[model samples]
Target: MTERGEGSNAALSKYEGYENWKSNIPVMYDWFTNHNLVWPSFSCRFYLQGTDGFVPHTLMITNCDVVKPRVKNAEDISQFNEEEQSPFVQRYKTLIHPGEVNRIRELPQKSTIVATHNNSSNVLLWDLEAQPNRHPVNGAPASRPDLILTGHGNDVEFALAMCPTEPFVLSGGRDNSLVLWSIQDHITSLGSTKGSPKLGPRGVFEGHDAIVEDVQFCPSSAQEFCSVGDDYRLILWDARSGNAPVVKVEKAHDADIHCVDWNAQNENLILTGSADKTVHLLDRRKMFVGGVVLPIHKFEGHKDHIFYEPQWCPDRASVFASAGEDGILNIWDHLKVVGNNNENARAKTRSAPSGLFFRHAGHRYRIVDFHWNPVEPWTLASISHDVDKTGCGVSAVIMLGTTMKMQEQKHGRHLPVYAFDMLRQIWRMSDLLYKPEEDVEEEVEAELIQYN
Candidate 1:
């Protein structure tokens, strides 16, 4: 930070360390990124490396563009505003209460939150836009339940998922049951201040003999969905009818199946993670050959831990990633998983041997669940058990950019890092991340919007 009285050369002399580091910014940026671990976001550049004794807190960059401008190129960045320019994370810490919050998910529109708890049959829903009173407002009720889904039997519910195209909530439980809840009916009941009838499942699907670990609706259709369970069974159910499964394949895997996901682009492809320490990509069209649908591609890399919900990349349909009980995030491209480049490699490995494209060791304990950002395919959010060795539990969400071209990130004289319009658009909910007390966007719109 140079004083007004100091000239350019004098300021350089006054802050020798800053001058030295500023000159090496571009070189440092280039040295820190690559094909395996790309730095997709602008904030990942100088986030935890501003001070003299600083190095970046985390290193997980995958791709970079040499042509884009660096933070040093910003014409009028205020030196004192380091927090705004280089905030690596924006954390929101509010406990959901009571339940251990085994799994949490943000809806497709990013407008609501749904969470499942350990040893509980009920599913909880909280509207993101709601501003309910946290404390007692004249002794009425403190934090009334937004919507309590009482559709399950006595057994604990394990998984909950929202349909992207419709207002339906799908949940599967240890009671060996699946319940479909209508969001419209829940909201309608909340709107009636006089209080309406107790809500119930729009439809209930039942067939699994053991605990239901995961349930996910197909990305393209609201009526169809799949569930995996401890009984080593994969059952496809129709939302309109819940009496029995449309398709149930017994002995689906060697061990228990932990989770399941639908391909974002291809409706026929299904992905499943298992306690057997392998991932199977299955084709729903002909999975049941002689009473069993064989795996199209099987991946083995997570060693001895469970891979919790292997997800298909939203942007790149062929690319997918998985979070495992081993506390690692592995990204894979079905075409590039195995090291075989021969002409018959695809044909040979289509049903057999496959490997990992990239692996990220981020968390310390078991990672129970994770979700790909609906808007940005490269971005992801993962939550860990955080166990006895570390803290209690930690839930993490990171938005990775860089699939499309991006402008250089520069800081300015006013506002926070979010004041930059380019960043604001990249994360549509930037306003919620930084609650600026005063107007800062007006002063720094022209420079940042060029990137947007």
Candidate 2:
């Protein structure tokens, strides 16, 4: 947190008048359909609203097909258009008792929608092309999922993931069980409408001792992935095998392992963040044959360790970002961090975290998730579930650039908001919370910058 009266940023005058904050947002957006647009790192653009005693639930879908110049690479990409031209998201359909939708993962392979549940152990699957039917016989909606994966020992499943290039879905739950579903077998035909392809549990990988919080498939492989759980374990599993994990690291963290991600550009690299407020970089190539081992590299600056995920920059091999309850989005450059001679420090307790490239503390509350834009390396989307005087709410999506034209807050230097202009046009910016070179002006002035 920045001190209240350390002094103001001198450059805050160059890009002035941030007092009218909401007005400077520029683009116009719809309210209803985009209710969940702020959801952090959402795998899919659609969200489910479950019903009450009598009121029916609504399925809100975003206009992914619309145009957002910032999201595109065309000329005058910064131009903001009116309602007709601006992207619009709306409530697409209605749903019956979907039983507390937890996560939605869109499989790139078939455009299938796989959603996990919080009230039941079952997982829901729907075809993106299938239109929702308001009145299906039972609790199922018109856009009923062709498959509902059952068999997780009656534990409400929250951890859900789909193979990046395949129709396979993986789910984990409180039952300490992991179930893999196959989309091929469950493509049963409907009475009238063509049945959307579905998926059913094909493999049940059992080895976890606590609730699984995250499951991610390798970006390069369809059959290999990793899972992290409250048990403090990180296990690598092959889709072909069911009984045992090919490699398992018990006590992978001093506290619960909340999240794990595979580096897309690297073959053997996987990153894990835990309740210990530390991030560990592991190489799968060296496991099992050896006894207990520490991370090839470890990071220790994070304050919120319970629930956060670290992602390798989709464009760069060495850069990655992490967001969590700390309300901070910290970016790191591995080459600069784990250089030519840090091997000796890789000994006992794995001392030093590669230096942080920069930090954006835009969110006044806790940040739940963040994702790097696969197409735009410098762009990122961060979501927060923190609510306070900032009026920040659950599932708030803030998109901004990594190193952008500077924007500062009223009192102090804030990486979260900047007021930079070129010809009176508001450039593409949001709470996407990223540390910019200019944001540290006040921090450096206040002696609040810390790098280790």
- List the candidate 1 regions with Cα displacement exceeding 4 Å: 1-86, 91-96, 113-118, 133-142, 188-197, 337-355, 383-385, 388-452
What TM-score goes with each of the models? 0.64, 0.66
Clashing pairs in 2: 33-90, 38-397, 133-142, 133-143, 398-432, 407-418, 407-419, 408-418
Off by over 4 Å in 2: 1-57, 64-97, 133-143, 186-200, 287-290, 341-353, 388-452
Clash number by candidate, in order: 9, 8
**Against the unseen true structure, what C-alpha lDDT does each candidate score?**
0.51, 0.54
Considering every candidate listed, which one attains the maximal TM-score?
2
Expressed as tens digits, the lDDT of each residue in 1-452 for candidate 1 is 11111122221222324445434433322111111111111121111101111222121112222222222322222222321322433222222233233444435543334433434787766542352323212323223345667788855544668888877788888788888877764564453343324457888888888888889998877898999888889999876664689998787778888789898798888888887778888888888767656887777777444546788878666778776556556777775543357724654556433545444443444444554544332444444332342332222222233222344433211111111101111111112112233444643464478767
In model 2, the number of clashes is: 8
Q: What would the C-alpha RMSD of candidate 1 be, to one decimal place?
A: 15.3
lDDT of 2 by residue, 163-267 (tens): 876677788888888888766544434222454343456788888888887899988777888899888899999866755897889988888887788887896
